[model samples]
Target: MTDLECRLLVIGGGPGGYVCASRAARMGVDTILVEAGRLGGTCLNIGCIPSKALIHVAALFDTARRQAAGGMQGISVAEPVLDFAAAQEDCAEKVATLRAGVGGLMERSGVKVVQGHAWFRDGKSVEVESETGTLLVRAENVVIATGARPVELPGLPFGGKVLDSAGALALTELPERLAVVGAGYIGLELGTAFARLGSAVTIIEAAARILPQYDDSLTRPVRRRLGDFGIALELNSNVTDWQAREGRLTFQSDGAEQVLETDAVLVTVGRLPNLDGLGVGELALRMTDGFIEIDEHCRTSMRGVYAIGDVTPGEMLAHRAMAQGEIVADIVAGHANGWDRTCVPAVCFTDPEIAVVGLLPGEPSEETVVSQFAFRANGRAVTLGDTEGFVRILARKRDHVILGIQAVGPGVSELVSGFALAIEAGLRVEDIAATIHAHPTLSEALLEAALMQASMANHG
Candidate 1:
């Protein structure tokens, strides 16, 4: 076995691991990152990037089909033929390009990238089994950024007809009938995309409503849009079994057994921390609710050991992990840093996308005021012929301090950063109202919402 030593070792070469290793190395710290797969992890390779590409392609095809059926806005087009194989190839190429970029960045940053599976030997030592041979790595500090994987159902395992999110995305041919076993963001996003791509999509949810995390107001628009796309929603339903041979899915809904004939079944219930086979049992790390516990600086219970991303507690988002990785790198490099961000924005890439940051209506202890601006009244949304949702702001009733901002509409994902900035900067409603917004733009909705909260709304 070969032996190596480093100042810092980051496990799992994902967004968090790579970021930590790259930042620490740039700061003159000896750093090494280990991974068994591609450099970009799930987010860059399979989860986020690939899913978004599929959604974009599906949307393009759906729009073209609509134009072909009935001309919209005086525009007509011939029926668009879908080349599923070509679309998959394009998506794979994009993922490859991004992965190569990540590899190049690591090489330039001087981070020693080890392509292997890392197993913990002790708090400060690890054994990596690569294709070539075994390599023993000893480091002063270790960061566990091993991400999570999709949670499988009890009776239905991931295989031929039954698939997980990753398997669904990796499909070469689109299924004619798709039955998604969850209504969360992952399920909804993929189900919506498949529906647009001409699948008879059916969403099954145990909860009473779709997107239980968001209130009714935000999810209403997406629900309406799903109906418009002819997607069937089976809320308050529980999956019981799946017969792969017959392609039959049985579920319990409203105290009755229901069976669905589908070509594929996608299970996206949730994600569990990928701690198995890592030999975490070798270390006495503190864990809460099956996740590694960490402080503001992402320091674990063991000295010089840190954890970030899905392996640790908090939102399982690429940006959140990136932020934690930066703070941990700073602290490891003798620079003082901690997790002090006010809020982490969340986006649901559904039909009419949902973006939310900071407090909701009743999240604040003090009395709050809510202001809303519908997209139907926004010139840009109206002109685009896709005005289906609204922008809303919540603020302190007495001080007009903006507590939270959320929007559900076309391209709201791009607007969430501004919402996070507003909350992080402690900008009040009056501040947003005073700032001039360009006309004929979707952002004017933000100004209008703030103005309404300030009782000075110029537009409805």
Candidate 2:
């Protein structure tokens, strides 16, 4: 085993690890990052980047199909064929490119990266098993950002017929019939994409409604889009087991049993933190439930060992992990830093897309006031022919301070930054209402929503 020492050691080069390593190295701290797979981790390699790429491809393909059905506004074209292999190749290329960029940044920043699985040797040290050999690494500070993996159904294990998000993304051919096991963001996003790609998609949700975690107002348009696509939704359903031999899903819905035969089954129930290989249980670290318990400073119970991202608690968003990574790096480098986040934005890349920040809709708060501006009334949405959803703002009735912003419409995901910034900066309804939003733009919806909230009148 080769013995090495560094000022900081980060495990799993996901958004959290790589960011921490790079930032610490730039601060002149001797940092070493150990990763078993690619540097960009789940979000870059398989989760966020690749999924969004596929969604974009599916969207274009759907547009072509729509145009072919009955040319939109006099534009006529033949039906488009999706070359599935080529699309997968494109996603792979993008993932590879982004991963290589992350690798280059870590190298140029002087953070040493080791390709291996790291197991804890102690609170201050970890032993890595690499292709070259074994490595014994010790550091003054360590951060674990191993991230999470897709949750597989108990009865329908992942293998030939059942697929997790990664498996779904790696399809060589688009399935004619796709059975999605959940209706959360991951499932809905992929299921909707495949449906657009010409697959007869069936979404089986254990909850009573699709996107049960989100409010009805935010999810109503999404549900309407699914219905428009003729996508089958079996709500209040549970997959009992999968007959892998027969390629059928045996599920229970209503009172009796049911069977759904499909070309492929995509499961996106949830994610469990990647903890099996880390040997965290032996390190005497404080854990909550299954995740490592960390404070505002991202400090674990074990001294010198910090846990961030999916390995810790809170929202498992890539950007959140990145923010925590940067904060942890600064904190370790003798700079004062903590998890000072105002909003961790949640975006669902479903049809029309849904982006939310800050307080949830109908959240029990006496001081919060809610107002919405429908896209049907917005000129930009009407011109674009996407006037299906609306933009809503929740602010304090007492002070008019913006508490949360939620919207569902075309390109709302792109408008998430503006919403998050308003809340994070403690901007008021007057602040947004006073700003001059560009005419014939979707963001005008936000300004209008704010205006309507302040005056209690329509922005017509």
Candidate 3:
């Protein structure tokens, strides 16, 4: 067995792990990163990047179909056909290129990249089992960034016609009738993509509403779009069991035990941290709700050990993980920084995307000022023929301190920076209202919302 020693060792080479390793190595600290699978982990391989690419393709298809149906001048085409194999190949190519780039970065930084399954031997040491043999790694500090996996239900396990987000991304053929088992962000994103690509998609959710975490006003536009697409929604529904027969799957729904015929079932209930095989319990690490508990500096309960990303998370987002990774690297380098940010944005890439920052749960304060402006009033939205959403702002009624910003509209993901900046800088509603916004733009809604917050009758 080979013995390895480093100043910093990061377990699991996902966004969090790779970023921590890269940053520390660049600072001339001896760093080593180990991964059992691809370098980019789930995000690049199966989650965010690939799924967004598919969503973009679906949007383009829908746009083209709408234009053809309207008989718009000079736009002529036959029925749009989806080449699933080509789309999958395109996604794979992009992921491979990114993975190779990550590998190259580690090599250039002199950070050792080990390919194996890592299990903790103790607080400061870990054993990696590789194809050749077991390798021992000892480090002064260790960071666990193993990330998460999709949760599997008891009665309907992943197999044959039933698949998870990862398996769904690898599919080459489109299922004629598809049933998505959850209405969370992942399920809606993938289900919408497939629906736009000509699948009769049905969404089954146990909750009374889709996107229960988001306010009703914010989700109204997306619900309307889903209706326009003929995507059936079964709310407050429970799946009892699923069986595959004759190359098709049938599932039993709640109340009367109705059967639904489906070519494939995509289960996206939620994700849980991948901590089972790491031998963490053996180290006596404190865990809460299946996640490792860590302090602001990403330090675990045990000394010389740290955890970040989805494994020890507030929000399981790639950007959040990246931020935590950078913070941990700084702390490791003796910079004395901790993971503290006022705003971490959450985005959902649906037909009409949703972006939110600094939104808190609870009863609205009596001194809270809320304002909203619809896309129907924006010239740019109307010009794009996609005016079906709105932007809402919440602030302290007394001082107009901007507390939260939520938006649902086309291309709203690109607007998250503005919302985050407002919250981060403690900008008052009057400050945003006084700032002039360009006319004939969707961003005008932001200005209108700000004006409303100021109690000024600017745009009716």
Can you write out model 2's per-residue Cα lDDT over 1-460, one digit (the tens) per residue? Answer: 7999998999989988899999999999999999999889999988899999999999888888888988976777898888999999998999999989998999799999999999998888899999999999999998999999888778878888789999999889999999999999999999999999889999999988888988887899999999988799998899887877787888889867999889899999999989997888668788877899999999998889899899888898999888989998998889999987888999999997999999986774666888899999988998998898999999888898888999999989999999999999999999898889998999999999999976753455
Residue-level lDDT tens digits of model 1 in 1-460 = 9999999999988899899999999999999999989899999988999999999999999999989998878889999999998999999999999999999999999999999999999998999999989999999999999999999899898898989999999999989999999999999999999999999999999999999988899999999999999999998899988889999999999899999999999999999999999999899899998899999999999998999999988889999999999998999899999999999999999999999999887789999999999999999999999999999999998888888999999999999999999999999999999999989899999999998877777878
* Model 3 C-alpha lDDT per residue in residues 1-460, reported as the tens digit of each score: 8999998999989999999999999988899999999898899888998899888888878767866686444576666777878877887888788889988988887889999999988888899998889999999999999999999988778888889999999899988999999999999999999998889999999898999998788888889989988899988788876667743433444565557888999999999999878988668788899999998888888988889999985889998888889988888888888866888999999979999998643445546878888888888888887888888898887888988999999889988889999999999988899888888777888989898768763665
Looking at model 2, the pairs that clash are: none
Measured with C-alpha atoms, the lDDT of residue 377 in candidate 3 is 83
Give candidate 2 misplaced runs (Cα > 4 Å): 456-458
lDDT of 1: 0.94
1 versus 3: better TM-score goes to = 1
Candidate 1 structure, TM-score to reference: 0.99
Off by over 4 Å in 1: none
User: Which candidate number has the best lDDT?
Assistant: 1
Q: How many backbone clashes does candidate 2 have?
A: 0
After TM-score superposition, the amount by which residue 64's alpha carbon in candidate 2 deviates from its true location, in angstroms, is: 0.7
Q: What lDDT does the true structure give each of the candidates? A: 0.94, 0.90, 0.87
Could you give the candidate ranking by TM-score, starting with the highest?
Answer: 1, 2, 3
* Candidate 1 residue 16 C-alpha distance from true site, Å: 1.1
